[model samples]
Target: MAGRHWPGAEPLLPRLSRSANHGVLWFGAAACIATFGGSARARRAALRGVASLAVASATINTVGKGAVRRERPVLDAVPVIRRLKQQPFTTSFPSGHAASAAAFATGVALESKRWGAVVAPVAAAVIASRVYTGVHYPSDVLAGAALGAGAAFALRGVVPTRGQLPAPGRPPTEAPVLPTGQGLVLVVNRESGSATAASALIRDALPLAELVECASADLSGALEDAAERCVALGVCGGDGTINRAAAVAAAHGLPLAVFPGGTLNHFAYDLGIETVRDTAVALASGSAVRVDLGRIRPGPEGPDGPDGCFVNAFSLGVYPELVRTREHWAPRIGGWPAGVLAAFEALRGKSPLEAELQGRRRRLWLVFVGNGMFQRMGPMPGRRHNLADGLLDVRVVHGGRTPGLRLLAAAVAGPLTRSPVHAAVRRRRVRLSGLAPGTPYAYDGEVARSGTELMIDKLPEALTVYCPMTAA
Candidate 1:
């Protein structure tokens, strides 16, 4: 064993080794951190750490120890008390404790640099303790550490760590088009993430602006009333809330101000208004831009053919079920995990949708339409720089094969925005027919039952909104 000469530290190291037996204690601690942190980032880091440890353990126990077939060090020189419970029956070429420690630390670091930094010292201690307990050699711990780190790096290709999503690059100019906070009505969703803090921040930043806080049930009416009162309607919520606010703002001919106050503020980030402070700066400088919104004309379900609007994207088929599952699990398990779980559940044994694409009948797994041009090439599609391009980024997954196989292709294919499995094009208008009556659709994170036939159109420069002047 590596540390037999250092008898003075044997007692502490042995006890620490016992506590980490099978890495159960460490996993439990990580779960606690994730559960208590109360944020999606923390939860994701915890889950990734657990996954890393599992990979490391499996590799070391199954492959490393088995392949090497090295024997554990004899305990003749080890302390009597320490030797009793610290004996590891597995081969000694690579230490499992060291592997788990390195794997978890590296995995967490990949997710959050700050949390990773905090865990690094603890992981180092655990790795050192393995050798100190006289069960493994120093070289064994080093080799295990190398293997664990390598595994974490390799897994990065499959799992996403960062919570901050990418947005469009900044445009070239900085021009102000709207005045500071004057005639602005800011409506905040009280139930959204950090709502109280965001509301306070917004009020402090834009003192001249009128502020309203409303529950989700009353959101539509509150938005309608707020739109009637201000020159520019400011919305502080998630994508769904922003979508509704956009519809009201467009109807009332009001420019919109987006303040990021909800979980996953995709639209606000794309507009270069990542925080309440950013919105404040943009409003103070009178910065604004014009973006396109997608208009969905009602089909057979509606008697009057009323128009519906979405600010982000719209999709039918598997996505609607996935969204529902994600929303149901998000509150308990956090966002990213919920999304992953939902994708699997929705894709399992799912049937393709039968619809007419431009009058041609086809079997489709999903039909996606973006408000404007979106980055269509990666695992996650992004926002467009030319928001007023008057083109809808339409993508469809044809049912040429099983739904599972098509989804797998999408996952493996890099830059799916242009993949063959993903039939994509930019169009001003797209008509989808042959949908069953009351088929659920997801638009901007909100689910609704729509009519069989749907007419989706890109209204060019239809929405003028407050944004950072240099936003892409």
Candidate 2:
């Protein structure tokens, strides 16, 4: 292949081969995809792409080269202009460049088809450049690419993609069909991440809908007003904002349409709504489903406290402090960086919360209650597959001197019925007492102060929300 070169290809092909020396070109591509792709799927694709590349590179260097030990091809017949300046010293039986390129491309394709199409051409060029640079025989490049593709598939078996799992099986509910978004009022939080840009897209997609842009403080009043004026209520924000909107929608007997406008939209993504377009399509066709909402109320003999609802999760102890700290730093730094800082700040010099769970006294570092059953997909707790299961996923970490180590061990152990450091169970209702007066709690990313006693349970199939049933 190097003996005969075509016109106008020498400069580009040689540069491409050299740029992919140690997977630098692929890493840069992954960074760009994570930054500009804008959706959760795009971020997943970027992460998987880098992971596949790492596996492929490791296999080629450690196993492929050592096993074959083949000599490099002679460059006598090849033109010096198309040849690489620094020839590779490793064996030529399997090309590492080809393996990395193919692995990254295949991994990305498994997550997102559009991004995969954009990345595949570059990967193909990098694979061909290895042979064109007179570094390897054609057979070596082919074998390396096969191995790379196999690596991606093997990784998929260990960690299944989102597409491989079934969508959340929510019971279908009926709603009004608003083709142009008539009779629908969408309240947008201007302070949320990407919300300002999403507002413009929502205007173009659903022009007839009344859009109310407000700050975090005014969200409650705006949602209350919109609930009274419109037949269906819509919200564009993070989990906290969606929690408020869901409460108002349920009280007013109105269906909710959620447009993901926050940094990490846990509730919206769980409902198969990733973008404004997804919710808009659902509203146009009146496609929706009924899901359960988690509630926290006063105990039988406790003070008359106001009832609250959580659409995602409710937690006590260090988690509430972590959410508070993260919000404080997220404006200065980015979300991911702020979360790391918050974890360190929240866990430092913190004491465990002493509470009674179902009349049993327990000392815990963290207590988590999910709206529905949460399963562990990989190393961490993943999304729910059935939103109306009428079960609360209860997990707790026992008090320990090394809080960080205990939490890490609990996470690594996955969801277990019983363990030395942690325990997990599925319950219909949970009762807690003996909390210190004015104890702090967090629900759906919002922090609040609670009384000494609390009753936690689910309101099954109580809220109807717009979501595409066929969405992956």
Candidate 3:
């Protein structure tokens, strides 16, 4: 009726609704726009939108529609010629389209405020079109918008928006004064991404510090040698390299300094050292914090043996395969794209690992245990606000009664929500057994074949790590 009063806009309104005929088409278009028409950050923001849409659609179509069961608005007053081309068959108390649009727009805005500004108007227009087409009441759309926005907020707890920061809480631990660059031994993995550049930056910032370039084979020896004579052990590499440094530092009773130089510098970022320059500042200021470390003991020796430590996270089952596939294809296709491909490949015909969790037998798709609570920041998991809390974040993806649909649902819904196939627990110790001998597992991004049993425990305030004063 409003469109009829404003005849000039009627033609375009229908066209817009038709373009978004199904929520999928509009979301696909949004993905394409994010990928091709925006910056890298915008592309990441768009993915969060996609995830929020999935969660909103599932919640609205299931609970929202089933609970209310409101009748659709009658089209008797609508002009027959102007009615929706294809009428919806379901009850219309809450509009699914409006829910999806609102969820996606809210999710995107959480990631990129600027991109959200661009998407909000379009989402609003889509919600309005539902009523203009005579399929929904204004009240129905309003309820749907609320549902969608709620879904987006729910996911924000598990999925971080782009460039997200650590949540505010207690102040970080202050550090005592120490040597800046003198007697500092910094090690770099030459093969790791941008190592040369990172090394140059580190040297420029800490000219008195000694820099050593080593390959994966020589890494352990070089670190041990450095720890013997140096006041501090520093490393610029990926999670795998950082894991090694942590082990050596712990054994030698030396403080560790890390610079983010790898594809995923999860440990370094958690320490508030995102770049070599940050490391330099931390070193000069002698700012440091004590953090806990995760230790994993296997039933029998395979490669890394019964004793090992992870500074970040540990995973078993399809996760290791996903990591391997991502590494193989990341250089050619890019990290995020490769991860998408890897996820599909890993999930195909995947069988859950049979294990005993807390003495209950269960079949699970993946088991992830983090050294400390790792929050969702952006595309990657975020830094732990309290690294020395001495707690482990254990997440399990269950096969449940049905594997395929349930697993897929949990993935899109974000890991924090309740699902038949997903669960998370926090503790200081977790034990698992009944694994086949020589099962492959990933810790801090490196895969290792280990024996059946696994014991995970946390060491409180195990190591001291240097970081910028601002991190405190």
TM-score of each candidate?
0.71, 0.96, 0.64
User: lDDT of each prediction vs. the true structure?
Assistant: 0.77, 0.89, 0.78
Per-residue lDDT of candidate 3, residues 1-472 (tens digit): 4335545547766666666655765577567757554233566678888888899999987888899988888888877666778888999989998898898899888877888898899888888888888888889989989989989989998766535565423234544344447878899998776676788888777878899999978999999999998888988888899999999998888888888777667677666665667777877787777788899887654346438899988888788998999889988998779989998888787777798877888988878888888664111245577777788887777765445565556556554644666776788998888777777889998888767778889878778888787775
lDDT of 2 at 102: 94
- After superposition, candidate 1 runs with Cα above 4 Å error: 1-40, 47-86, 150-167, 170-185, 191-211, 227-233, 249-291, 299-306, 318-354, 372-393, 397-428, 434-440, 449-452, 460-472
lDDT of 2 by residue, 1-472 (tens): 7788667778788899898889899899999999999999999999999999899999999999999988999999888888888999889989899999999999999999999999999999998888888898998999999999899989999889888987777899888999799999999999998888899999999999999999999999999999999989999999999999999999899999999999989889888888889999999899999999999997665556568999999898899999999999999998999999999998999889999998999989988999987767211246888889999988888898888988988888854667888888889999989898778899999998777888999999999998886852
Off by over 4 Å in 3: 1-180, 300-306, 331-334, 376-383, 400-404, 412-418
Candidate 1 C-alpha error for residue 139, in Å? 4.1
For residues 296-377, could you state the per-residue lDDT of candidate 1 as single tens digits?
A: 8877654364588888888988999999999999889987799999999988887888888889998888888887777544
Global CA lDDT of candidate 3, please? 0.78
Q: Per-residue lDDT for 402 in model 3?
A: 49
TM-score: model 2 vs. ground truth: 0.96
Top of the candidates by lDDT: 2
Q: What TM-score quantifies how close candidate 1 is to the native fold?
A: 0.71
Summed backbone clashes in each candidate are 5, 0, 0
User: Which candidate comes out best when scored by TM-score?
Assistant: 2
